[model samples]
Target: MSINLEGFVRRKTKLKLGGKEWIFNELSLADFARLRAKMAKERKVNLAERRKQLIEEAKGIGDIDPLKLLEHLDKPVTDEEMDAEMESIEGVGYMAYLSLKYAYPEVTEEDALKMLSIDKIEVVVGAMMGGLSGDKKKPKAKAKPV
Candidate 1:
């Protein structure tokens, strides 16, 4: 004879199982269904939604093709929007940006114009490390200046 275990579950109460009497917390039927639906919706959007929002906001300031944005999708990004799609890498510096620009000639001021569209602000974070924070690591001292 086949039995449906779900029928045995108490709506919102705890369930004790087996000879050892192991107990597990169970949510109310409504709450369980609601939580499952919410999780599914969240999983559907999450990162992709943030990327789209960031691209939309960036485009608002000027004209840009979403496809061009796709070229740099897998690349590092600047957090210049409400969605804050990209994160600030802790140890990156100005030299790193210059090196990156030097390495990838395609990442020009024009690309910056497309991404952030801020000419005076110059290169984006990936291009020039966004002009490093004022805080700097202390320089090592010379041994015995005497």
Candidate 2:
């Protein structure tokens, strides 16, 4: 029997082949690997164009070390650590990070957070918000009828 994996709880308890109850906390290495590989395959099935765009954005960053960035993101990094790591990368900003993330898919929330911390990302967001503010528009005065 198959259970809906997307739900909070798994429905099926027994594996037909092993004739044993399948427990989340007690999954074997092979079973876990199989599940992970299935998820990864699903994620990449139709993302070629998006992946290309992310690669282009990374290329524009010049020397930010994509592999290391991916590694850093895969493992959790502290906010302070992120600040120190990105401090010296020229033109690396919040907007650029967002663009990069938009183009490429992240496997975890930590990776998503790392993309948000880019300097260009902040500048781009600020500009976008600034343009939407209505504070600069003045109210028109009403004329009295004679």
Candidate 3:
């Protein structure tokens, strides 16, 4: 017998951003991975572009300790760094696009742009990252019939 899981679900929210209300749904694991992949791709491109320059700049340094140079390379990024990166314009836009795409699969690129703006991107990012919780309406206490 299969058990029902209908009661377990993330909240869908309706909030104003860019002077308009857009309903947003929680990002699925795949959706979140896509955003992370976008950022990782950018980081890879930057490192590739700077590889030659970095090597040339480091030339003539007698003793090279590769371990010391890349010791923290494998370390995971800190939460603060991730937060700061998401706050950037590119990150904010991509995040907003992903959020919208997840919420509305039929959303167009033009509409996605319209959904996010400079003044409200932070709020949108915050909501997506769980920095703000007031977006969800609170339920009132049930009263007993007298």
Candidate 4:
């Protein structure tokens, strides 16, 4: 017997932070493939090495200008936002990385930092993986003839 899957194409959730509301669209297989390709191209290292490098880089920098890491993101950043501080830029980057698309109107750098203070890029990535895993269907077991 085949399991019928309907109405499972897109999933959306709302997130509230710093008196602002944001919508998150569940990632699809295509999104995962894109993310994997982006990461492979940007990091060019294994996961363990990448983690170590990230930690080392963070420790090495006294004042990190997040805009410098804009190349790591899948989306383009405007020149105006490029001058913003690290936290805000990272927040926007993290959100954009996980979601299909997002927009924030008149979002001040300070506001973005405040809104995304508790969110970690790693967590968003893990959530994306989990969402993808949940979408997969388990293999059906074969029936034994009597």
All candidates' lDDT scores?
A: 0.37, 0.38, 0.64, 0.49
What CA root-mean-square deviation does each model show from the true structure?
Answer: 24.0, 20.9, 5.8, 14.9
Quote each prediction's TM-score.
0.19, 0.23, 0.62, 0.35
Best by lDDT: 3
Error of 2 at 124 (Å): 45
| Candidate 4 ranges with C-alpha deviation above 4 Å | 1-9, 44-96, 100-115, 119-146
Model 3, 1-146: lDDT tens per residue? 98896777655567786567786666666666676676666666676546555555456574764445444343455567667876677666666677777567888656766667676665665566554643545689999999
Whole-structure CA lDDT of model 2: 0.38
Candidate 4 lDDT score relative to the true structure: 0.49
True-vs-predicted CA distance for residue 111, candidate 3, Å: 4.7
Better of 1 and 4 by TM-score: 4
Model 3: residues >4 Å from true position, as ranges?
1-8, 16-20, 28-30, 60-78, 108-114, 126-146
Model 4 weakest lDDT span, ten residues long = 78-87
lDDT tens digits, residue span 35-92, model 2: 3444345445645555565567778988766565445334333445434533433222
**Where does candidate 1 have its weakest 10-residue lDDT segment?**
11-20
Regarding lDDT, does 1 or 4 come out ahead?
4
Best by TM-score: 3
- Supply the global lDDT for candidate 1: 0.37
Model 4 clashing residue pairs (backbone) = none
Better of 2 and 3 by TM-score: 3
Error of 4 at 19 (Å): 0.8
